[model samples]
Target: MFDKIKQKIEKAKGALEHSDERVLASIPETSGLSKKDIYRNRYNHGVNLGGCFILEKWIYESVFDKGGDNEFDAVSSQVNHSSVDEAASKLTKHYNDYISKIDWNWLKNEAGITSFRIPIGYWHVGNGQLLDELPFEPLREVYSRAKPWDILKNLINKAAEYDIGVLIDVHGLPGGANTDMHSGCKNSSPSFFNKSKHIDKMVNVVLPFICRDACVNCENVIGLQVVNEAVFDNSAHGQKSYYSRAVAALNRIDPGLPVVISDGWWPDQWADWLGQTNLAAKVVVDSHVYRCFSAEDKGKDANQIINHLSESISWPRDRIDFVVGEFSCVLDEETWRKTAGNRDEWVRKFGKVQTSNFANVASWGWFFWTLQFQYGDGGEWGLVPMVKKGAIPRRPQGSPTVDENRVKEIINEHIAYWKDKGGDAMEHWRFEDGLRGAIADINAFAQFDNSRIGRWKALAMQRRAQYISRKGDSKYMWEWDQGFQRAIDEFGRY
Candidate 1:
């Protein structure tokens, strides 16, 4: 395992150092006026930095035992401390190592991905689902109130060096957005939707970093996703009405910035829901389509498995606007067996088909599930290995020139509109500085009691209260404060 990880990191280093000389003989055509231009000028071709910040979707038993599902799990299990100071030291080292592993140069130069959707858990912020709850306080007191966002913030700035834009995705909400362990806790009945505090915490988690959230801003961040996969069942809690509240809150924070909402297995319903809210064009829908998990695709042969997306690949383009949030080339076991002869050919063809179909039809664009996972396993699903194999084309076609003068006119008009409303206009995403300044600005916002956020906070509170009534188990994870103190006090070395 150690050898494999070492090899992977070495390969990434090599790619970063030599990809331009080896594969990209010239500046790729996709390179141009990008950064914030990516979200509007052309469809975004991107990749997700999954399991990086929020969750650890890994095969390593050690990581699981260490409880990397959420920040609370990680701090409680991985740190053997006799004091708060010691625990903070361990967490700082652990988190820094995790975020440092990201190879931003490779993502931009090697894979040629245009944008990045980074999944961040709410705990990584100062306040999560509920600021006053257990499992949440550790995040605040331990990490300098979420100063660790420096890594992600740096990545965003580094991406601009390659002209790549980033989409800040809050993959995990407080109390678990979905039943998946990726949401921080695995439970059949997701508590995220069952409680109102979860929604409030989500607002807390998203408000900063938003270009319009405060006077501070992140320049390369083109989009902000409220939730990853908050499950949608037949119950009222699963309905799109809940998303509307989230949408309303985010819009109130940054009306110009795109607030991406997931399709959540209901394409037409979500499209209709957003349309009704008059935010259809203003916001983008995220639909994660996968064939590997479905019983319908499991029994199919290689051809059928690869061609499954052909039927509905163009659905969003034809009907509404949306982005394929996640997708991979992995096939069912039956499909794998049928491809015994010439495995490489079939794999390449499948990847090309999915890749082409998505760019052609995914209205907003497509993000491969991940750039890489499990240290260096850049397997069939990993964009790094796939790009190396040439299964995925890294050369993005040159898009049409954007009307820069028209854009300026629109911005000037928008600023005047806001100025008329008695609110000082913000720099917004296109003009703001990158992550470092954004983080410092946010920190100062807290310290100085920034008054601009009053309106946004009031709107968020209204939405949280408007949604799910607070009637159930108010004391879930009630012992966090005591446990946090005990964890700090009980430390005397491992």
Candidate 2:
């Protein structure tokens, strides 16, 4: 079925008149939004729904207490102690109960989270058949009966009820992307980069299925994250190559569906690459920033760490759409110990600074590390606890309403300032058009869930291209660009 779908798309690629048309065609006529337009252009206040599908011992220790460290060991231990059928039943219950509708309500109403990053392994794909030749191959029967993919689909659909978007993250790949236990196995060496077969399965089988089924069948699926936290040095070349193929495969199915790639702990290099590459679909660089893990971070006090973060953390705004995919309020014990204030007060200060920086810099906002843990709310690491403790904001401030009269006042001021200094041939009307266009877009998005528009650069680029194509290119196109940007800049002021 996928082969036939791919063949049809390959043929369609040649027949389409313009690259943008392929994207435009995928959008529903009623909504006037491509998946990218709706999902990628919003400031995402999200949380990672971890320890649900991909097992992590630290997040949920009970499952591992009776077994081994990671998902692989847990399943193996279960099958050894009991029967495969018993193991499957136990795992299935965990999947169904880990996250519930009540939790979704809390996320939406209390936390004001608009999106979720759901992490799943490649073995969770298509009843675990895609695990062939991989380490999880022998344990395929366990997941086959558990039907994780089916449960994930149901979760996506449920998220849509509250107008929440989902980023389907293939956290654990065919071969381990990193040595961490979250990569699906314990103490496994990173071999995904060196193995061609591992790359082939992801580019050919896993990603395509995600694009074709999840993005197509699930309305609230915002995007597909190709891999999570790939080792920076080990998979640099291979990761880049894999991303190129993954983008191509996803674009062929739905040109508007955004493809997300991890920064591999090197944001600048990937930002440079994004600037040079001409991608057909939208791409987001997921950079996970954690201050607790590094030695340098451990040495600094809370104030010093906050100052260092504000000064050092930077994203290449002109190049790529980026997000702080994972972050938390937890600081190293050394840093906390060295601080000269109440621990709760410092936690609040740290969380505020991180959220502020992320909102100001990240094209798409941030997602807290994990939503919940098995034992209790994940304290500083959890979104719920942080929000309750007056750390993270319950919801981002709403975009201020900009009426037509208010827009005219700004336009008049702009014309007055430029009148004596500018050429008579200046297209001031272009500026008015651009300003109105931005207002319309913002208004349209708010109707869905009172959400504000984000990724202004990408939105402007798409609008400018369409505007020029429709109105015919002129030397005064810069007027439209300025008008669009000014509205975005001044959106909440009035």
Candidate 3:
């Protein structure tokens, strides 16, 4: 069935014009770099630096920190009273306070952190679902804070001023994408797969930012990331179609800015969808890989650790020439485990662990998982915390001290060797080979269905099963088989 689908795609190859014609006409040609650099644009390792406005999401979405005070104030109260919630709240306060004081300019100018990814959720900036119909009065009041245009300009100006490349990611979606990442939608929301609706929001509300002169103010603002981890289910094509529409909208703006796309988060493996993209050379595909949760952590041997990291990343290497948009290597297992779930701790740790073993062979420059959100188990990813409710927090003030000089030294002394001695350099596939095999296994399962719609359905079913099994809802997983079957039947119709 999958082979038939692949054949069908091949047959309609002419009809399926993958490239966006508008984008090709506008973007400036790649100049200055050698042909090799131009070809490997996908390999630029960029980081999402600066402060993100995440606490605002929680404030607006009604995901409060339980205490009427902000998460920070609440934490103070909780800690004083010895309440778990108070401890969490105090942690949140401390984290946000720390980040808000961060020096954004220092990161770029002084530290040489060249790339930064900034996230602005749909709702926080007057573009989210509850924009016109927010329920809570406080939420509605908060939603009225800043318009999208204002935020876009602010981001562009910051990037241009700092001489850092920017990736303006649509961190939130209407009705919400079902993921715990930045977009705070609850788990398994039906809204995740609602393709047409998402496209509408992207076309009308989000795409304009890509075209704005503010965003295109400089080459430093490289691309527009449509959605961050829209991974409720495994609808790769559905994700692609939404991204395609996003690219099409940008192309219309006549800004030859590349569209950065990602594979919805799945643990196993993935194939590249960006290679076949229809756009000019400006398109820079991206992916994020962080696998601290896998059993590979317990393997204990140094060889096992290397094998695990290598296998974990094989998918990104094979699928697209993407930068490791976000990742980290935790040296202490106990500390790392605590950090993964705590946003605040992650940021603190990420700030400290500037030298990584993986940095030497990194496909692209690395963006650590976070800079803020200091309270909670994995809050370490965040540099500081914003006392918000559910999703990732905003970039706080003040820059945490990273061993940037040491980091540069490591990269120059070690990783730079790979760039110079081409033949002697470790092969890209060497690191990513294991994960590639897993994706191949899945792609084989995908090949038979000639219908893209059917393939999407099958993938969604896989996601549902995975979610179900992980959640220990075997009964619901079985019960939902009929529903999944019906979805496949309905989607297969057209």
Candidate 4:
């Protein structure tokens, strides 16, 4: 069985290499860039961006702000490091301790999860607001001390214990990934369109971590996801080119490792993006389905939701595999509202759409939204919580109910089941035959009758129409939209 799995891995690798050829043939190389040329390679495949840095909202705020009764007060209360060695020592213990508390084996074995998305923090690496120039070389001292490779070694060691892969994602761009989260620089203005400035600093400061020995090990480190959810409304061409250049450079250091390119919120954009010079062959397209964020699923049912996923894959289905990247939904109205402590039904609805539609996924796995979040849907994420603020009594989600032991049991069962069944059977059970099982599950629950769901969805649709009228053209119609309707149309009454 192990030998078969090994053979399958070899075949898949070969297929992946050949797929690059096909994609390259379909797309032209950037001028002067060759297959062996690192700058020429511009594709990214694999899972990335869970928690760390920008995603750890509470931690960032708590540790950095001088005024709050925050958890990171002591850590934040120090003079910034003067050298790389000092920075490493300052963060090494705290960082190592954080990972040690995690149930790495359980996360790997039970969650059917592989790949850890570690985010790099700007301040931790010494590029604070005081520095005002490009290349951010002043950060070299801080970065040198912070010991990212050392931390990565520890993370990889733990991950290898469970046979998982690791993908390092640079989360905070210079101006910040978006305006709402601020970790990269002070006076960190929004960079929806001005994100190009990040490339210079990344090349000088961030490239070493990628080229280092700790990162080259394939047994654990799989690839580098350049940045998390790059906002494409700004610098689309520069972002694409920078990614291509980064891939080429990294490939120079480690040829076998793939690079992951995260597209803007709209993944469909990549269909045309693939034909761009130096990008098609080295990329795995990424899209995030937040019935909440995209508002793409307003009133869709299980089958309809799945079909939407299938349709979304039409362009890249043959050439590039996509990562769902993030997804979560709320199922029950009353429970959701009570849990959320407000009327953010859209978020809940999106979660439901995702849970309902996940099976039809062509080639994907998810990192889920965060390790933790603030606001009503707080404590919701990849089975853990970061420091708690916004609500009192900070606690892990499901707490006593969703303990490590229970989560471990769930994750282990899934991992073992997949391992024993092997990827093929797992794929069949999940994609081919799973739809029938899901429909039957929904149908079996008398309370969730199709007719009732339809009526509820209709009312939701009516409200959305009214809302859209007031709001103007928007994608928020969600499960109530045409993408979902087509799915129901195909599934045919019950």
Q: List TM-score per model, in order.
A: 0.67, 0.88, 0.52, 0.54
Q: In model 2, what is the error at residue 400, expressed in angstroms?
A: 3.2
Going through the candidates in the order shown, the clash numbers are: 2, 0, 74, 31
- Evaluated against the true structure, the overall lDDT of model 3 is 0.42
Poorly placed runs, candidate 2 (over 4 Å): 1-31, 34-37, 396-399, 403-428, 492-494
List the candidates ranked by lDDT, beginning with the highest: 2, 1, 4, 3
The CA-based lDDT of model 4 is what?
0.43
RMSD (Å) per prediction: 19.4, 7.4, 18.8, 16.7
Which candidate should be chosen as best, given lDDT against the real structure?
2
Better of 1 and 2 by TM-score: 2
Candidate 3 regions with alpha-carbon error over 4 angstroms? 1-46, 49-51, 56-100, 126-141, 146-152, 232-235, 265-272, 277-282, 296-303, 315-319, 331-364, 373-494
lDDT of 3 by residue, 1-494 (tens): 33453454344444535654322211111112222121123223244532345433232222244443232233233444565444433333433453355467655444444456766555544323344432122233323332333555555566556545566666656555554534533434536446575567566665674456445445566567666665535556666667667777886774446566555565222343444552423344445655445564543433344445544554433223344566643334643444335544443333333323223233334565555433342343442231122122222223222243643443344334456666253432211221222222222322311111112222333344443443344432332333333322322221
lDDT of 2 by residue, 192-232 (tens): 87789989888898899888888976667888999898887
Task: Please provide, for model 4 over 18-115, each residue's C-alpha lDDT reduced to its tens digit, 9 standing for 90 to 100.
Answer: 55332222111112222222211211111233334332445423234333232122233332424345434555555554565566544543343445
Candidate 3, run of 10 with poorest lDDT: 22-31
What is the C-alpha local distance difference test score of each model? Answer: 0.54, 0.78, 0.42, 0.43
Instruction: Give the poorly placed runs of model 4, Cα more than 4 Å off.
Output: 1-55, 59-62, 65-77, 80-90, 122-148, 186-198, 293-315, 330-362, 372-378, 382-494
Model 4 TM: 0.54
| Superposed Cα deviation of residue 101, candidate 3 (Å) | 1.8
Candidate 3 RMSD to the real structure? 18.8
State the lDDT of candidate 1 residue by residue for 247-338, as single tens digits. Answer: 67666665556667776677776656655666565567788877778777777776876766677665544335677888877777766765
TM-score of model 2 (CA atoms): 0.88
